[model samples]
Target: MFWIDDLWKFGISAFVGTLTVFVPLLDTRTEALDPIPVVVTIPILKDLAEQVGGPYVRVTSLLSGYENEHTYSPKPSDLIAVRKARLLFEIGLGLEVWISSLVRNAGSQALRVVTTSQGVELIQDDADTHEHPHTGKHTTDPEGNPHIWLDPANALIMLRHITDALIEVDPSHEAKFKANEAAYRERLRQLQKELSDRTQRLPDRRFIAHHSAWPYLAKRFDFHIVGTIHLQAGTEPSALHLQSLIEKIRKEHIRVIASEIQLSQRLPELLSRETTARVVVLTTMPGGVPGTETYLDMLRYNVLQLVGALETT
Candidate 1:
């Protein structure tokens, strides 16, 4: 098994290694690149890269909104992005399985891959280990909950990582990164106040999410995750699974089933009917849906949705 794994790894390495370059450039311009090419896994980093990179940096997001970050298929163009990127930012904690191979193929240790989920508290997926539908188990944040972005307080930690990486790669932009971090941190603080106030109004602070994506939110707002609609990131729920969740809902009187905007809503909506719980769409990724474009707005939108759903229930 070990040799087999090694051989498979070698095959992937060789393929990606040779094809790293010659793919699409994120944004094309004739001038010599000034800031740096930074490849990020999801939208939050893209948003941050925009703020911190400003005019100096050029950013490319590997996964689009329709593309699930967890189970991403790297086009040759993606390898090209990795090949050219001076720095790669990811939510890490095994959130991106393709990173290791892609980096290996790019053959640039100097690329400086930064995992934003670093140093934040991680919750083990102890509820169950099955994979969900629409993607693989690899698509799920395997190291732990990579949804640290959901917590505004935790995003501050990501800013530190971003600043350090930017300063390391482009020391000339140290002040710019610092300034960006300071400004973003201030906005985060205001968002914290807003989230606290909004969450405080939920008469029933307890609700169940489709998965175990709510611990940070629950911790922040004193809400409770009564049960999960799915056991894993893409695994389908069986009859037994549905029956078990129904029992928990009945016991807890779970008012809302917080289905993430990124995931398919069929199961959550169906579970909502089963439990008589309202289906609430929450954004895990920045811009995962229509209303959650900015970090603060995402939190506000989720809190408002949760508060409104639970309060009315």
Candidate 2:
């Protein structure tokens, strides 16, 4: 027969042994259930986060593909997203003026804001030529133009920023994040090469941009931008500017006018009517146009559309 105290001790030991075995299992289950939450200002960033994060993160984008980045106002849901996110990615060249206020309003101490355009070389808008009156102030970095992602090279830099942020937050998944980034970059390079082959053989690559958003794209693929319709966002060009563009198009025999879907088609159409140039509508954001749901698809569509127009003209 065992003493009462000895029996009690044995029972307690057994309970402790069982708990020791189950505690780690419980921790593992909990960790698996909780994924890192991320928020991005634009759709492109959201896509990038998804590509890098894979199954480890949940991402939300504030602006859909059709919205204008320069003039977008934040919604109530944006604040809620920010409050829950561990990381918030933005382009941050004064492109998202509303983001600062949104983050402040959320007041999440743990949320980290990552600027993906930190290392990108900026194109300075010709202040002398690109000026217009505005109904309200637009956010443009005095340092340079904010539309850096249009260039594939700049996209690589943005990817690095995103990968680094993911690694910092979730070190355990560093290997996966790095691998995803590498694979994505390889795909980007391949696409760029394919597009370059298409554009390189073109006889004429000159076109008028609908807005001051094509400089980076033009520089990357050797396209020449002869003129821009809207030098400033939300401001109509003066009659004098329009007349000059028409005259220049006729004089230079510029055959194509590249218009963005996000902007009003009124000016591009008017210019097309006044001049002989054909309008080739393109999208700056993914999913703005059909077959452009992803970043790669958007790039291919824009390049091929412009190339086809240029070749025909």
Candidate 3:
């Protein structure tokens, strides 16, 4: 009877030892599979983060490209996302004016806010004149235009910042992050060259912009921005301004009017009706339109669509 009891005790001891040895290993594996939680202010940042972070990050974008970034009101879910995120990326230069309050409300102790626009060259806008007429909403940044992502070259700067932040948070995946960035960089350069070459053959590269979102893109692709329909977002150009633009468009033969999908098409359509210029609907953000889901796709779609319109009209 005593020998049988001793054998039972030994069996229990062996099982306990096996559990102690295997439990942590299983836990470690599960922990490794859990991705880093990231929050971004705009879809473009989300795309850049995902491109660099790859499987290492789970990103949530506050603005889904459909919303006007300047006028966006943060949702409850946005607060929750910020609270859960280790890294929060923004274009910074005052583009996301609501982000500070959102992050403050989140009360995340461990959250690090990364401004990708830190080292990039900024384009200044007429902040005084660009205020929304109705709501008095300030559209342009006093610091600079926060649309740096419109240029592929600036996008590369943003990508580098994203990679650095990702590496800082998840140092174990540094090689993967760098590699992904390099690959995407090459792709961006190739696309940039392709677009440049295409634009080179165009006789008329001038257009009337829907808003002040095209300066960076225009600089990159050599397209001339003849006039802007809405100097300030959510504010309509006056009849006098519209008349002036119509006259300019007809005189300059600015065949293309670059309007964004995020904006109301009424003004652009009006311009088209008044003049021979064709409105080529473009997107400033990824996922703003079908087939422009990624940064590269949006860049290609914008340039090619504008080019097609310019050439045909």
Total clashes for model 3: 0
- Cα lDDT, model 1, residue 299: 78
Clashes of each: 7, 0, 0
Off by over 4 Å in 1: 1-33, 127-143
Error of 3 at 172 (Å): 0.9
lDDT of 1: 0.75
TM-score of each: 0.82, 0.88, 0.87
Task: Write down the lDDT of every candidate, Cα atoms only.
Answer: 0.75, 0.88, 0.88
Clash pairs for candidate 3: none
lDDT of 1 at 106: 83
lDDT of 2: 0.88
Which residue pairs come into collision in candidate 2? none
Clashes of 1: 7
Residue-wise C-alpha lDDT for candidate 3, range 184-240, written one tens digit per residue:
999999999999999998878899988888889988888988788887666667899
Residue-wise lDDT of candidate 2 within 1-313, one digit each (tens)? 5655765877977767978999999999987677789999988888888888898989998998888788899999999999999999999877787899999999999999999999899887765653421223333435577788899999899999999999999999999999999999999999999999999999999999998788898899999998999877767788999999999999999999999999999999999999889999999898899889888998999999999999998
C-alpha RMSD in Å of predicted model 1 compared with the true structure = 13.1
